[model samples]
Target: MTEYNTVLAPVLSAFWDQPNSWTLETYLKNGGYEGLKKAFAQKPEDLIQTIKDSGLRGRGGAGFPTGMKWGFLPPADGGPRYLVVNADESEPGTCKDIPLMMAAPQFLVEGVIITSYAIGSNHAFIYLRGEVVHVYRRLLRAVEEAYAAGYLGKNIQGTGFDLDVTVHAGAGAYICGEETALLDSLEGRRGQPRLKPPFPATAGLYARPTVVNNVESVASVPQIINRGADWFTSMGTERSSGNGLFSLSGHVTRPGQYEAPL
Candidate 1:
């Protein structure tokens, strides 16, 4: 039998087994928003650099560098930019994101706030899979809780940083998992991939610069901000740094989600 004893590193899943793990109160008690406070201390560009230094790749397939993806946006015009979280986990056998949303949604919420602030976005969206009504409801409630705590909305934490987050449910198209397709679906159009050249960074979501990141990718940002780049680099390989959630199922005695170094 292969041993995962020392290989497992459960940063995101660390508290899933605890009582009321989804509640804001529980999240606060366990050093939840400390990362945002740290983020607020740094310049937005520096925040992006930190992720680059951490070597944190996208957990939503493709392994794209998360920081580089953020840096790809053209300098801010006087127009609206957006940060969209792709919560539509519809690929066959792909199950990590849904469970993360259901069990510890605050993690994604905190990550969204920090990401929006870093990217100079006044608005953000979580595009969820339509069939998961329960996850959608949980995400909505989490957003409401965040707003009440002043972690979202106008003048957040008195820093004069305002952000509004919208939770949108898709029609459950598997293609919507693709970033461009997800943007189209979010805009009330049919979910289909668009031709490139004017990639999402150049033009997206109402024809403005936009960033679409996966649930796990955004959720991992809080830890990178809080723990420092070197800490994240200590895990996984030199190329693929940091840990990720691995969904194991079908023909396995211990089939479940495991968070460990990539």
Candidate 2:
């Protein structure tokens, strides 16, 4: 067997706690943001390096390297930039983010903060799939709770980092799942894909440089940051280890967002 399979598969599963472990209280009790605490104590560059070492790949239907993707940004060039969490997973049979948001939206919230801080973005957007009004409402409530708890706002956790997070809804379009199409829909335009190369990392949302990451992708940030990169990376395959939100749908005896190793 490959070494990744031996170490990664069991490591992530070992953390599997009760079903409600998604809740903020539950997550905290289980030593969740202990990583966040540690991350905030370290230099941002070191945190990024830990992720690169851990090998956390993107799970938004595309297995891109999370760290390398963050590295693609230009240094706070004074132009506005954004970290857009794509929660609009309209892909046929894929179902995870909505439920995760419903059960433990703060996971994504704290992740948004850590991600924004890492990339030097002050504002982050959680773009929801418009059809799920109920889910959106749940997210709104969760964001409110997080804000009230000091997770989202100026002076996050006394780190002197000011950040704001907004959860926006889309008009319900499959095309909107495409990076550029999502941006267009976010801007109130008809949904459609745009040219590539100069992708979202360079020119996105309002023509300002943006980092368009999937909901699960952004949510995974806090864990990678808080835990040593080696600890987070010690799961999955050599290329794609670390826990992933597999929005399992259809056929399976239990169709749900199963957090599994890649």
Candidate 3:
């Protein structure tokens, strides 16, 4: 019988097994925010282009190129734009986002900062599923840790880029997994999908230009920012490049999150 690859790729899951892995100190010690540091050195547009050239796609079923989605936003217009993280991973076969946030919350946090910078967003939100109270508490603490470390506040790393992250939990609903519904639920309304045309890019979250991306998509930003587009494109196929977390379930021997080329 042929044997499948047993070794894990382990990019986002690299430090998951470390004791105190969820803490800011642990994350920083393991080269956590270096991606954000490198991102600050470069212009936001350049960063977007790098991601575009990398061919990284959204892992939230759409498989849309992540960089392209960012490019779709209209000009900044000097007004506020927002980045909403779709952490409500309620899809049938989706389980990567929660575990990622639980094991290495910094990955998502760092990704949020970079994506916010790339898209000119000062405020970002993580809309989590409310039923997972433990996960919610873990993420809340993670955000607090990030703030105390100067990673999520004014003049981050002396780069003059100010940002604030909010962790919001949704009143469990599969429909909220839809980006628009998630936004509505986030706004304290009953969870329901909104009509399209005025897409989130144009008007979202209090009628502001918004980029709603899945947790994995946002989490992938740090790696692309730190490693470069060329490195990201080295994995997967020509069109679908880079690696991602595969949610494995069932009676399989090593069932869990598996990181592999997409």
Local distance difference test scores for all models: 0.93, 0.76, 0.90
Candidate 2 lDDT over 84-197, as tens digits, reads: 988988877777767677766767887887778778888889899889998898789777877787877989889998888888899888888888898998888998999887
CA RMSD of all predictions: 1.3, 3.7, 1.7
- Write one digit per residue (lDDT tens) for candidate 3, span 77-158: 9999999999998977668998988989989999999999999999999999999998899999999988988998999888
Clashes of 2: 4
Candidate achieving higher TM-score, 1 or 2: 1
**Could you give candidate 1's per-residue lDDT for residues 1-262 as a string of tens digits?**
3686678999999999999899999888888999999999999999999999999988889899999999999998789999999988987887999999999999999999999988899999999998999999999999999999999999999999999999999998989989999999999999999999799998999989999999999999999999999999999999999999999999988899999998
Best by lDDT: 1
Model 1 poorest 10 in a row by lDDT: 1-10
- Candidate 3 off by > 4 Å: 1-7
Better of 2 and 3 by lDDT: 3
> Model 1, stretches more than 4 Å misplaced?
1-3
Error of 3 at 151 (Å): 0.8
Estimate the TM-score for candidate 3: 0.96
Residue 177 lDDT in model 3?
Answer: 94
Which run of 10 residues does model 3 get worst, by summed lDDT? Answer: 1-10
